[model samples]
Target: MANTSYTRSEELKEILSGQETQLQQKMDEAKDMASFLVELVDTLEVTMSNRSAKGDKEKPLRYCTHIMEQLDALGWDRVTLVDQDLSRVQIELCDASQRKHLITARFPPAYPTIPLTIAPLEVPECEDDQLASQRGLSVGGLSLKQGLALEAAIRQAEGQLEIFREFWDVMQDFDERTWVIDPEKPTRADKMRRCALGNHCSIQVTVQPLSPRSMPDTKLFGPTASIAPMRTKLYQNAGLWDVKKLPRENLEVLLELEGGFPSPVSTNKDDINVGCGICYSFRFEGQVPDQLCSHAKCQQPFHRVCLYETITTSAPKT
Candidate 1:
């Protein structure tokens, strides 16, 4: 009986020890799972926070608004952000009619030191026969937010004073008074009359250049044959030669200087070489009528038959 009791007690001890070992293992596994879950939650939270942080939307919005206000203060009607980079923002400024002007703002990669570049979106046309000039900016490594802010500040401040000076020559105005011809004969008596009239005198003048002959290939000799003699005589008569005033009327001669008249019966009908009002070439000998042009400058003096052919061929097409 005594032995039986002792054996039963030993068996009970062994069973209890086995159960305690199993419980410890289960607690360790649960702890490990809880730690893993905590780590996963932390990583997820960080990622979500980053997505909605101020840097993503708030920073860009803030910078853009500041820039826009600056542009408005500088008399700009509209501004748009076309592109953004680490060190620059490409902006387009527009007027009421939607004409755009491009500008760039440069900033440091670390930010704060903002600079600007501005240029017209459309190329300025050369006016008054002047050459077209280009203007604009450059940048360094800068954040988009910094660049936007910088650009706005630049436009609002003293940057608007920038001007582009063209290196082109100034167009000369056409003179008419001194360049005109006098039709009336000048005599020593006319000179005396002009001197007496002085400031109150107005002479009759023509803008035409006198021709020595009515036909081409006519020889013009001496200063008298040229306009020089006529100008000299008129100046002496007017008593205003010292002033040598110029005329204001636009003057141009339609006559073209050619080598000679076209041959009446040239063998080559395929082509003809002739000079026009300006230094331009015209080629139409054996082509269809539709290929020819009938501008006054294009019509070179030709033989009667050639002229007829040209008219006949082109008239049908017209």
Candidate 2:
């Protein structure tokens, strides 16, 4: 009886060992840090800029929160937020010439488990200012994936890695002599349109989430003699964005963009002012209101979203 019990125990140990081996193999097959990020960004439609009147400071449950704690321990501060959301954060660095830049990273809806997007902040509208233009555009063009790898290595498996410092260091090290361009990278101009005919037109695209990864990718051909065909083809490419109508070259589209914002559509009914009555700030950033309250006498122009939100939030809690 004693011999039989010992043999059974040994067999159970062997079974556990086999299970461990199988688990290790599965982990080995798992996607690496970079591939995971590409998948995550593609899944989330990670754009450089996303502004909602509502806010982005979403608090994650596990991974991103761990990273945030690590960042706080490292003394890096949160990005100065308009809505005070912690969904995105940054670290500021200055070169020898005192040129300052901000390294910003944003946590997607599913973060930590999915790699965070680490990139420099961009102020495209303010490029005329020497410092402002360069602040978010890094000199080296080092990929965000590489920075994430560096962050992991620096942590040395002690705790969760922090990406902000790694990003800052990489940009500081970039110089003309050290920078080398890789031809295979997706260029800034052609990111949305991948040219197949070799003219940076006749673009191809694939949606990461909505379509199956195994499915054949689709292409959106650029303009020809008349834009009518291109507009018609856009119907097939409706997955490209939320809108169905291709932007018209006619005055309607032009006027919409030009007059996108008029003023504060809704504001503190009491504050009679020339600027946005909601924020009550004189500085408008050259942006006007896209919407106006319908009453002719109460013609308050407002940012479509700002006014909508102001009115929505101000409504009585029923």
Candidate 3:
């Protein structure tokens, strides 16, 4: 019998080659990751540079002033800073349905990066049975006991006001419980589907309940959202193959429950390399209807000619 050990040299060489290639891939990925993080810091730095160079106390003042100007445009004269630090403010805001609400905002020494603290100065408390009738309490899945315990919490929040800059808009969401995708809701084999909006199940995303404008940003662009643009730029900077990778799910999930805020898609953009699943080649431009998968879940675009040829070869010629 031939020496099997010596004969397996070819297999060993193949294994070694595969490992070398994998090592190179890992090196490339590491380099890319580092580059991406630097680019992200750079973007943040640019945004920061554009901001007024103010001390912590002054920074909150400018942000509040910007906010006040916005509120004043709506004929609101009730916004007032009530705190010595200028971190807290009281505003009279009206919701979409035009119901009046008294909202308060208190920013930590760290404001935007960490959500601002907010409270509804005057939202009415409800009976246990009325928990469901209460916008936030019912949908938040709070037990009556939990809801009652949160009366203090209901009155206040460390919230998403940093992103959602309007009193009425933010306060209304505080009152209305938002639908959270069950993290355990599996859309694809223990992976709950990221929304066509590119939102993850665990992340808190605010939807303007029943609004048509909330549809996917565009078939190709995803959401025309404030957060998505920055994330897309980050993903591109990272040279990540899939730009839609979510990095902020953990923080977002907590903020959602804490503040009843919606999740913004803090992730890479909806840029996918569309390749022919048949011929296995990608294209930046291809025939729209024939090249693209119309199916929502699978949207790789194929060469229309390649697809027709594939069909012809597989089927018996008449």
TM-score of each predicted structure versus truth: 0.21, 0.25, 0.23
In candidate 3 the C-alpha lDDT for residue 159 amounts to 28
Clashes of 2: 15
Candidate 2, lDDT over the whole model: 0.35
Q: After superposition, how far is residue 232 of candidate 1 from its true place, in Å?
A: 20
Tens-digit per-residue lDDT, 207-284, candidate 1 = 111110111111111112233443444434433222122221111121111221112232132233221212222223
Residue 129, candidate 1: how far off, in angstroms?
A: 18
Residue 307, model 1, lDDT:
53
Q: What is residue 98's positional error in candidate 2, in angstroms?
A: 2.4
Task: List the global CA lDDT of all models.
Answer: 0.30, 0.35, 0.37
**Which portions of model 2 miss their true places by more than 4 Å?**
1-60, 77-85, 120-140, 146-318
lDDT of 3 by residue, 1-318 (tens): 121111224423332333444334444554465654464456445444544244343454445564455445534465644565556666655444455445565654433333455443332222234433443443322222222112233223322111122323332332233232232222111211122222311122332221212211211222234235534543344432222322222223322323422433222223223235666543324432235555667655566777888888899867
If candidate 1 were superposed on the true structure by all CA atoms, what would the RMSD be? 25.9
Q: Deviation in angstroms for 38 in model 1?
A: 50
lDDT of 2 by residue, 1-318 (tens): 111111224423322333444333443554664553454344334321232323434443454456656566645443343114555666554443444555565654434434556653331122124432343323332223433632442232112122123322222222111111111232212212222221112223331211112122444332243223444545544444422222221111322224321113422322323334465532344453435455535544455556778889999998
Query: Would you give me the overall lDDT of model 1?
Result: 0.30
When 1 and 3 are scored with TM-score, the better candidate is 3
